[model samples]
Target: MKYSPLLSELISALTCLPGVGNKSAQRMAFSLLERNRDGALKLSAVLHNAMEHIRHCERCRTFTEEPVCEICRHPQRNESGLLCIVESPQDVLAIEQTSSYQGMYFVLMGHLSPIDGVGPADIGLDELEARLKKEPVEEVILATNPTVEGEATAHYISQLCDSMNISATRIAHGVPVGGELEYIDGNTLTHAFSGRRKL
Candidate 1:
């Protein structure tokens, strides 16, 4: 028997999530319908609420319910001579897991991609520069992913820092080539931070 239009649409919508194919979407839809109607409703409600309530923090660009995220609001986090640069909020979480970095962070929200027309402006580089000038950051760590694009983005930022006369560095070689910071273990991340070198 064919499923109703609404059910088919719901299953199709579920495929928007990464790695969820049609089969998995269908299974998820069936599971939600069969044994957990209330759970499914709660899921939908949470999704809607998060979409409406969560916004990028003005300082770090991490998603938060308030104007500034918890990290930016923290009193004890090292505000002076801070580190600044990241690809995403997940990267921030990964670094936080290590508990080794005490400096403030600035999320890029994206990397520089010339082909994709994603330039420095697209990722809030202007805001980053402004922050660097306004804040007392002695070092800026470029913690982008270990990919070609990530390297290019880091290089560009490093050059920008040279012009601004701010000390800049990149995370050390403990991070595997082509691996993302979010995927690396906390211990490795801690080592990388400790061994960071000048750009």
Candidate 2:
């Protein structure tokens, strides 16, 4: 059976979301039309408003409606003199959930992938360098993912920090708090051993 033109368009649009394929999108389109038209309208309105208003934070590159994100504007975070560099805005949200870190953040938006043509300049290293030179940041915590590209990005940022006479430290990559040693991968096991502290 052929879907109506508007129904087909709605299904296609829903498939653009991550993990939502054609089948899932079709199901969603059907469910919205048959069961929850009001909810769908609300979703459409919110999505349109967000698309129109949301933009990257000027300082951290995180999604926000304001010029700078709330974290960047917080005076106490600035006083901490710590800058945590992360790969994405989601990473910043994850770190904030812990409530353990009291510092500002810089979102890279992505890792360096030479094969993909990503470079230091592409990931906002120039802006970071300028911030380092002007701000009183005493330490930079590289909280990028543990992928190969993430490692390279962290190393590059470390060297940049060194050139500016600032300290840069990579977040430890190792086993989780409750993870069993037997289930851990070799690379993660190695990192856990290498990052071990005297306890």
Candidate 3:
């Protein structure tokens, strides 16, 4: 019932991943050791290389090995003059997957959570403000999540945009399309009602 020290260490390290608990980590470690040592070695090498080389893009703060991310380096992104603000690099990937947006992004890395001692500066708001001042942004799209912290962060950035006479818009949050009203939460229902568009 006892794993070797290295196996135990591997399980513990795997547990550091989000949603990977002790049992899941143990399963992964055992699978790698028992059936795929070569694959495990490749994974370790790739992960180590990524950790060593990948860093935040200077312009948008998204992950990249080069100085700037591919999206940020795209000249048309600057020409679009629309900057979509998001709370994490994952949000950028989600938006890109849609292929509907062609503008640039500013990844906050996190939302403002004062209770947890997270502030604007901690989430790269200062860098965002500087970008707004220096760049020729026509509008800022606040694509933060619908959580309380996300709303607070959006409001703060909106106010900052107002001070600089820049247009700021928050992405609408409401009941999902095809979702029945009866099953929707009151807050989502209210948002859907208020955010209704003309037919």
Candidate 4:
């Protein structure tokens, strides 16, 4: 069955989202038209508003609406030199959800994926170094993902820290707290074993 031009356009636009294919986009488009036109209009309005106003924070690179992010502006967060370097704004949200880290964050927005032509300069490593030099940062936590690109990025940052004499630490990657040894991957099990602490 052939869809109208407007319906085809809606489906095509929806397919731009991650994990949303042609079928999913068609379903979404039809659902919006059949059941929730008002909700769809509201969503469109919000998306437009956010697209117009939201931008990366100057200091940390997280998404924000103002000149600087709230976390960068907040006076209560740790100012004594602890910084967590992460891959994206989503990582910032995950860490903030923990409520355990009191320090600020530095979002790389992406890792070092050379095959994709992304390098240190592409991910704002120079800006990070500038921040380290200008600030009183005593330590930096490498909170990049556990993937190959993430490891490369972390190592690169660690080397930079070594030259500057600043302490750099990688976030421990291991099995989850309640994970069964048999269910976990060999790499994760090995990491957990190696990172084991004295009980």
What tens digits encode model 1's per-residue C-alpha lDDT throughout 134-165? 87778889999878889899999999899989
> Candidate 2 clashing pairs?
none
| Prediction RMSDs, each to the true structure | 5.9, 1.1, 1.4, 1.4
Candidate 4 Cα RMSD (Å): 1.4
Q: Which sections of candidate 2 miss by over 4 Å? A: none
Q: Could you tell me which 10 consecutive residues in candidate 1 have the lowest summed lDDT?
A: 75-84
Clashes of each: 1, 0, 0, 0
Cα TM-score of candidate 1: 0.84
Task: Provide TM-scores for the models.
Answer: 0.84, 0.96, 0.95, 0.94
Each prediction's Cα lDDT score?
A: 0.88, 0.93, 0.95, 0.93
Candidate 3 whole-model C-alpha lDDT, 0 to 1: 0.95
Model 4 lDDT-worst window of ten:
73-82
Better by TM-score, candidate 4 or 3: 3
lDDT of 3 by residue, 1-199 (tens): 8788888899999998999999999999989989999999999999999999999999999889999989998999889999999999999989999899999999999999999999999999999999999999999999999999999999999999999999999998888878888999999989988998999
Candidate 4 regions off by >4 Å? Answer: none
List residue ranges in candidate 3 displaced over 4 A: none
For candidate 2, lDDT tens digit of each residue in 61-109? 8999999989999999989999999999889889999999999999999
Considering every candidate listed, which one attains the maximal TM-score? 2
Worst 10 residues of 2 by lDDT: 56-65
Clashing pairs in 1: 81-138
